[model samples]
Structure formats: C-alpha cells, structure tokens
Target chain A: MADPAYRAAGEGALRIEPLGELAAIFDRRSQQTHLVTQPMPEILAALAAGPCDATTLAARLADSFDLDGEGDAAAILAERLDELAAMGLVEPV
Target chain B: MSTIRTLVDLLAGRRDAAALAPREWDGVIAVARAEALLATLAHRLSGAALPQPVAQLLGDARAAAAVATAQAMWEAEMARRALGPAGVHFVLLKGAAYAAADLPCAPGRQIGDLDILVARDALPAAEAALLAAGWEWVKEDAYDDAYYRDHMHELPPLIHKLRDRMIDVHHTIIPPTARPNPDAASMLDRAIMLPNGYRVLHPFDRMIHCAAHLFADGDLAGGLRNLWDFHCLTRDFQARGDCDSGTPDGALGYDEWLGDMGYRAKLWGLGPAVRRALHLSAALFGDEADYRRLSLGDRLFRARLLARDDWGRETRPLLRLAFYIRSHWLRMPPLMLARHLWTKWRKGRGAAR
Candidate 1:
C-alpha cells in the first residue's frame, strides 16, 4: 500500500493530505497542487461540507476571479485537501 | 512509411492497459507530456526531427508539466554550481537522462526521485555536502541505512529541507551483490564528460544500469514502471547509437541484450507498447529476449518476496525470521549465520533492561 495519506478513492478521485510541513495542498484527483491564496480559505470551507468531485468544486470556485477561468479547480481543491490532510484537517472517510 | 500512424495505432489500441487505470489519469497525463518534451529534446540534441507518432504519443500536458518542473530544478541545481570548481559533478541517471536522450515516455511516468550517480570515492563527501546543503535523510532506521551502505551502492533517500523535492545520490547503478558485479569502476572511468564537467555513465554501462536497476533491485512494487523504464531506455539507446559507436568490447556494446528486454516485455504481457517502442526507437534499447531470459527468475523471486507484506501477523514474524535466516545464510556459510545469530541474540539480551 502507498503511504496512507495519499490513498486513492474510486475511479477519478484521490484522497490526499500532506504528510508534514509541505506547503501547497495536493489534489488526489488531479495528482497536482495549487499555491494558496487569501481566497483559498473560503474555497476550502465550501469543500468541507461533502465529498465533492472535481467538476463540482470547479463550479463553486468563487474566489479565483483574479486568476483566469476556473483556474485548475480540480488541481487546486485536491492540493488544498492534501495540505489539510497533512494538517489532519481532512481525511478520506 | 507511416510512423505517426503507427504510434497513434499503438496508443489507441492499448487503451485497455490494466496498469494505466484512470485513477492515475493525472499521472497518465503527466507521463504523456513528459514523453512529448523528451521527443522534442532528443530531436534538438540529435539534430533530427522526431517522427510524428513519437511526438503525438508524448504530448500529454500533465506529464510534460511535471517533467518541466523536474528539468528546471535539475538545471537550476546544476547551474547554481556549474562554474565553481567545488569538484561537484552532477550526472543525471535513470529516467531523467534516458528521457532527455531518447524514449518517448515521460519522466513522470515513473514517479520517484531523481537518481544521480557520483564517483564512489566522492560518495562520503558528496553525502555530507548535500546534507549540509539542506537534504535530510528520509530513512533513519539503522538497519536500513546499513543495508544500503554495506549491501547496496547508495544512500536510502534524501528529501529537500524546504521544497518537497527528493534525490537519490549513488556511487554505482547496480548493487555489488547482483550477479557477476559488472565492472562499475571501469564504466565510470570511461564515462564521457559533457560540457561543465558533468559526467554520464558510458552508454553500455548506462543500458546495463537500467537493466540492473529494474531487475536486480529488491523493489518489486514498482515492477511495472521499472519495465517501462527498461523499454524506454532501450528505445533511446537505439536512437543515438553514438555512445558505443567504436567499442570493440562485446560487453561494452548495446548489442548484447537489447532485443531480450523487448521480448521479455512482450512475454510478461507488458502490452504491445514494448514491441512498438523497440521498433520506434529502432532497437536502440533493450533486446527483449535477452532481458526476458535473464530477469525471469528474479522477477518471480521479487513477486514472492513482496507477498510477504500481505501475510497476517501470526505469519509475519515467521516470515521475518525466515528472511533473517535466508539473508544471513546465503551471504555467508553455516558458521557465519550461527555466529551472526549469536551476536544478535546477545545484543538483544543486553538491551532488555
């Protein structure tokens, strides 16, 4: 098994949290990460309510206006979740 | 006559790849892009336009982005100390160099750290230098460290103190215990130095190194990726054919077993990609048959060894004890195993406070 923190979910989804002080959360879904911005706190909160997939999270990306179009919604959420997982804020349930 | 069409055919038909599941779509995309960039780089380096099929097969954006990151990091690290006479020679090994030179495969396809081979005499100082520079030892277990130092050829792993980047520093590509320990020192001695004094393993040794790394190493978990590495490297070797162009030595040429690797990939059902890759790279890579014949037993051995992880706790200790016995027994004669066991027992008793 891979390190538990980077486990895979069903098809097209991944559960990621950071293992430690690594900045930038990883998106298990996209297997990438997004650098955090001030608007990220709001974005992350919206994601916490449920097990949202990449397409859903992209539609809810309200704070990425300064950035262009959806701005890697899948990659951003996954990376944030990875960071949160590393911090023990989120988990694959 | 139809190079691009052939590649598209290979990619399109191999859609049922068991290992290429969509859960790893991101990794897949990353690998595709990396392969595309590699094709471009090889074209530039060899001064020949890469065939259309090769370019199309590699053009995935995700894999390319990761390769771009790794390449940038590698270049920055090399450039930072490029001019100084700090006696630091950074030679990229395994996937990075292979991808840079040949192979339409992406570097990110095999997700792992960058492996660099330094001279053996410089091993200790190099380790110290990197440690001081910010890479921390990720594996702290003494037994594991001893295993790498004594039995293997390099350090375990080191992760960047700040960035999440990781690197594996090495003195040799193949372990000393594997087979008739190929003449590593001689290979290094003949290694060609690129501009900036950075050295790469002599072509023959580099090919053999890839073979040794994939087959001889104990890491079976990455078997699929390892096979992919072998396949890609073989293809790249065929392309340049410049490294070992004049060598009369049988072992120092790529002719020995490049075909064998291709045959083995097919035999193990690694899909037609291996065969296609061999043809695409013009048989510059592994010989499928030779590689297959040599590695069959080792692959079986690794599969069994890996299954030890799935055993229940009741059987786990027995397995561990068996490994302890086997590892010691084969490494030495009967007397040595007894002697070693006695020493271990005595040490355990002493620590039983």
Candidate 2:
C-alpha cells in the first residue's frame, strides 16, 4: 500500500511556462555559485539567445568550459532543464 | 536540500564521503524537499524509536522506493496472528508481500488499507479472529456492510482498535459484480502455501488478480496508480525468472501473459501512464517489457471492456444507469428494468405511509 505523502509526489505533474526567463534562471542554477572571470560571458551569451533546447545551447556553451566529455555538458544542461521545469519554466512541449 | 542530496547518495549506494559541486546542489535541494515531506509522514506513523533524522530518511526513502515497510511490518504481524487461530489460511497481499519479498526497500506506493485473503468458508471465523486481534468492524450502515460483503471481494476494511491501522479482509480475488462473476475464488484453490503455512497466491493467479483488480474495480478512479502497480509487479515478476512457463498449470503463457497486460494498458489510453511507471520502475529496479500484440506506438486504445461488459445484472440500477448513459445512451435488459421498476414501486408505496 502506498502512503499518501509518497503518492502525492507521483501525482504532482510539473508544468511548463514563461518559456524564456525560467530557462535562463535554471541555466544559472545548473552551474556554480562563483562566477569565474571567463565562463560568465559565455553563459550570459547562451541565456541571452532566448529559450533553447539543451543540446543546441550546451553545444554553444562548450567552448567556454575546458571539458572533454559531451556527457558533462549534457548533464549540466539536463540538471538546468529539471530545475527550470520544477520552476515552471520549460515544459514537455 | 541536504536531505534530498543525502537520499540520492543513499539511493546510488554512495555513502563514504562526497562533495557536491554548485551544479548538483539545486537538484539535491528539490529531491530533499520532496523527501522531507514523505519522511515526516513516515516518522509520525512508524512508531519506531530511532534518531529523528534517521527515521525521517527511512520514511523518505520508503516513500521514494514505493514500498511501505512500517505499515507492512504491522500488517504482516497482524496477519500472522489473525490467520493463526482460525487455521483458515491467509496470504499477505500486495505491498505486504512485495515488501516481504524485498522487491525494493522503499514502501510501495499508497498504503491506504492492508489487503489479505482468507478461505471463503472461513470468512466468519476469520472475521471473528480479526476482531479479537483489536480490529473494529467499520461502522457502516447494515446495507453498506451487506452490499460490500455480498458484492465486493472484501469487507469495508477493519481499523485496528489500538494502532489505527486499516485492514481489508478479502474472500475473493476480484469483485463479484465485475464480468458477471469473476473467478476470484478459483484462484485461491491454486494458491501455493508458504513454508510457514501461510498461503501465497500462485504466480499466475497473482498476476491475473492484479489485472482483474485494475480492470474491474469501480470508478476508473485510481487508473494511474493501479496501472503503475501492474507495470511494476509485471516487471518484477518477469525479472525474478518467475515466468509464465515456470508457473504451474494455469499460469499465463509468455505471449499471452505479456500481451494481455500490455494490450489492456494500451487500450485504456493508459500508455503514457504505463510508460511512465515502466520507466520509473525499470530505472529503479531494471524490469523490461516484452511487446506482444500492440506495438509500443499504438497507445491510444480504449479499455472500456471491463466497465462495459458487466453493466447489467451487476451494479445497482442507479450506478448501472450511469454507466449505460455514458456508453450505450439507453438502458436495456428487460429483467433489470423490471427489477428497478419493482424496487421503485415498493419504495413509493412505503413512502405513502
């Protein structure tokens, strides 16, 4: 038998909205708190471009971060998307 | 956030010492908030003397794992005793068994009421024994009690007089009104007894029981949750190498087993819900689906068969009339029509007093 508290989370469907701003804020939350001198401009550029899917935006932002893996970029992007979705930023659409 | 982050670590089996970068922090926070709410409920109910944080985490983890450990422990203990004296035979059903089987440490989904099965002939004795064990008969009108006992598989649920736990004693595997007498009792005859003398439903019977419960239970209300249970149980059953082939005589054959369940889920516009359940369960416990008739793509099929087939001669005319209006838009079956008319006539005559 499922307890009510556990069941509530399963039923609570996250909704999407405010297409652009939500994405930007989540994208920031996806990264670190300390704004490094160099990567900040690139993140800003990516967010400034308006609402974009993770794949394309992550690709654009890759040059700013010295990382070897696509997984790292994807992971960061996915976390941002989750944060955005939780905040009612981007939706399933 | 710390709670959720810790939960993720626990779930991932990462206990040593780990540092969370800024990026992982928010996800951790969201998970923690969700975990906290669930943990709070568990702590309140478990009655276990543990550290507050530890109890909360176990509760939270149980919630995420979708299995009720605390409730299950209580029910299993009660069930052991309830069926012990009668020797009438009983088996732990659903979450209780699933938890016992160690499917997952998390409490399985919703734990509204404990469900158990007893011998049909032993129902009276079983009811008495349950009452003796501190369960109070739910105080419903006699008509409702009679309605449930005669028509439904289980009684109106017995709440523990002391602990406030709810128990559902079932004599049949499915609702009697569904499909003009579903074969619930027949399944019990084939139930395999545990080494400890308790009975566990035969694998095939168990699987079919789940399907029947989801299909025939009225209201189509908990469609999503029921489907999720079906999906998880199916996957779990399959993964344990407890396939239809290994099941004794009446078990579902591989194709039929998967096909029937898959088809039913797809037909009911429940594909998305099923998919979500499948994905979530699989992610947690690696259960796979085998497609038989319907491809994964054709998900919008109508599952009105269960609700449609037994409209007449089953449910009360009032409820049946609602079903009739929704589907056929006209009431038929002259005998039922006559019965309704006669009942109404009697009611009116009595009212004249």
Candidate 2: how close is chain B to the reference, as a TM-score? 0.57
lDDT for each residue of candidate 1 in A1-93, tens digit (9 for 90 to 100)? 122222223333423344344336554433445455544445455565566554555665644444355656556666765565443234433
> lDDT by residue for model 2 over A31-64, one digit each (tens)?
1122123332344456445545556657767766
Per-residue lDDT of model 1, residues B1-353, tens digit only: 12221222233233223333233333333333333323332222232233444334444433455655454345324322321234656566766555444345543444347677777877777777777556789968686687678766677788766555677877766555443355545656767665534456666556555555544443333333444455555555566554433454434345555554434433433324333333322222233332243245443432332232111111235544554454444344476446656867876898996
Evaluated on the second chain alone, the candidates' TM-scores are 0.54, 0.57
Relative to the true structure, candidate 2 reaches a TM of 0.47
Candidate 2 residues B157-227, lDDT tens each?
88876556788888775555443243446556766655444566665455555555544443333333344
| Number of colliding residue pairs in each model | 36, 18
* Consecutive 10-residue window with the lowest summed lDDT within model 2 chain A: A2-11
Interface RMSD for each of the candidates: 11.1, 18.8
What DockQ values do the models have?
0.02, 0.01
